[model samples]
Target: MSEKNRDGKRTARERLAVEREKQKSAEKRRRTLIVGAGVVCVLGLAAVIGVLAANAGKDKKGSEEAGPVVAPSGAQGKDSLAIPVGKDGAKSTLTVWEDFRCPACQAFEAAYRPTLHELADAGKLRVEYHLVRLIDGNLGGSGSLRAANAAACAQDAGKFREYHDVLYANQPEESDDAFGSDDRLIELAGKVQGLDTPAFRKCVKDGTHNSWVNKSHQAFEAGHFGGTPTVLFGGKNIYQDQSMTPAKLKEMVEAANRG
Candidate 1:
């Protein structure tokens, strides 16, 4: 072969080899980038999963720490959520759902308490008081729950009616969370004769029926009632009637008793 031709051929082969090496390097770089991206995606997903798992663990721990639901003594109705205040054989049933911190509830109690007492005492009507924490959810305080728990403690002492009346009579302003204090609740217990014993004080302070009160509130929510002081007579929501009054309630109870 001629020297020039040989030189040209050698140069061509060298250029070909260089081009092949460039292609291989580019392929390797592409593969590396793809593998790196996949690793990053996997790590990001794992981080999110870890955070979610940690949050779920925290929620489960909190639920476990809440303890069990303990109903008060002599609690009646479904799930023992109702505190009964009269003879069981009464002709009519009056279900009252009330919140201690609700101004409307206090007003209702002030208006109808006399008739309720008279009817209950005469064994003409049985009152099932289901206490709730509506004000706590609305106004951001624990007074309603605390007061309900205190009332449950009174039920244990067989003085629920007296203490319940005292609670309404001495209810704080709608914005005041005075009932949240265990000392205040115990102090009120003094108003009800034979209701301020050590056991009652302990029950009030320790929130013995807190879980029960929460359950009752849940029941109230499930009922889909409008608000606190939801009074039901013979399965009818009498409190919603604009014409409902203490005298009207008394007449209804008498009519039901006659039937």
Candidate 2:
């Protein structure tokens, strides 16, 4: 009955209005879908980039330690570090690079020290210990720097060897709290015999001798370190097959002398 009905057909304007309403709904749905998809794409890209960045950083840390590289694949570190250091300052030499916090190194020290001392004191061989502890930051922020410096201090007091044994003997388990704190190390340094606490404390606190320790830790990354207790027998590694033991070291040193 209205003017629109009087026209006997829907007015073109009214039809156009209905069509526009349907189009508006469809357009809204399309816009929402586009926005959602864009968000998903951005998030996915960020995740991928994050993973790659992490891997790259780990690789860089590893490579830095690989140079001055000693390949642990053949002859261990024997030829490279000179193992079986002869007693009595003999013809052969045994040099050890060890980390106190390293369980393997401690084990090796326990196993070999007795026999090595017997030989050294008997005037058959000259055995030397090189303290190494630099890998802590890479290994979870438990570097051996504090202990290394402490050993340096002991070295100054002519108790380098004795303090070395005490440090490892009292080593705590690996943890962020363990190696990072100097308190525990200082306390342990006090335990060594013939060590002047004041002089040793000054040496360690100054941190000058830590550089020597850092070098060996750097050796680890290059695969030069098969693990703790890496002994160099006449610059060659004797027990290339397994981690070192005192008995095994004793046998290896004796064998090297026969050669």
Candidate 3:
């Protein structure tokens, strides 16, 4: 072959080999980048899963506590705390199943507090409060159970009614789970006369009445009551009657007594 032709052919082959090497290097870089991106995506997904699992575990633990519930001395009936407002010969008994976190219960307390107290104070009816954890079950928080336990603790300190009133008075919005904090409960106890003592604080912090709260919730379920603020006058569902009013409640008690 001619020298010039041979030289040109060798140069052409060398150039092709160089282009091939460049293409291979570029492919290798792209593959490395794709593999790195996949690793990062998998790690990010794992982190999210870990966080969700931890939160789920925390929620489960919040619902289920250890040990049996110990009812306070003030507890009466089958998992209820009796707050007697009237004389020994009251004509009717009003059993109330309430949750601290229930908005309806808060409204009921606001509308009927005065009338109920007047009737109870006059020895016309006995008010029995059964605390439940319905809100906890519905809202997925410990607020209802914790507040119920705190109320039981208040009963131990002989300030249940006062503390109960204060709790409703300062109740947070139904969606805001403020009562989950033990400190907030203790802070509220300070408003009630003689309820902020060391023993009371200890009872709240140690969740002394958690078992009783659970038992009360069980009682509520067993009773087959529909929801919180279940107002029963002599075992009759007063809430179901559309015509039922706070005034009508008093009249009913008087009429029942006469008959």
* Candidate 3 lowest-lDDT run of ten: 37-46
Query: How good is model 2 by TM-score?
Result: 0.58
Task: Point out where model 1 deviates above 4 Å.
Answer: 1-65
Deviation of model 1 at 92, angstroms:
0.3
The C-alpha stretches of model 2 lying farther than 4 A from their native spots are: 1-88, 219-223, 242-248, 251-259
Clashing pairs in 3: 69-211, 87-123
Q: On residues 91-175, what C-alpha lDDT tens digit does candidate 3 reach at each position?
A: 6888888888877678678768898888887777788888877766655578888898899888888888889999999998766
Prediction 1 global C-alpha lDDT = 0.80
Better of 2 and 3 by TM-score: 3
lDDT tens digits by residue: candidate 1, 58-166: 3221111264789999998899999998899999999999888776677678778899999999999999999987666555457888999999999999999999989
The stretch of ten residues in a row with the least summed lDDT in candidate 1 is 56-65
Best by TM-score: 1
By TM-score, the better pick of 1 and 3 is 1
lDDT of 3: 0.75
Report the C-alpha lDDT of model 2 over 115-180, residue by residue, as the tens digit: 877777666567756555533442433346567656666665666667777876877764443644
Per-residue error for 47 in candidate 1, Å, reads: 36
What is the C-alpha local distance difference test score of each model?
0.80, 0.55, 0.75
State the number of backbone clashes in model 1.
0
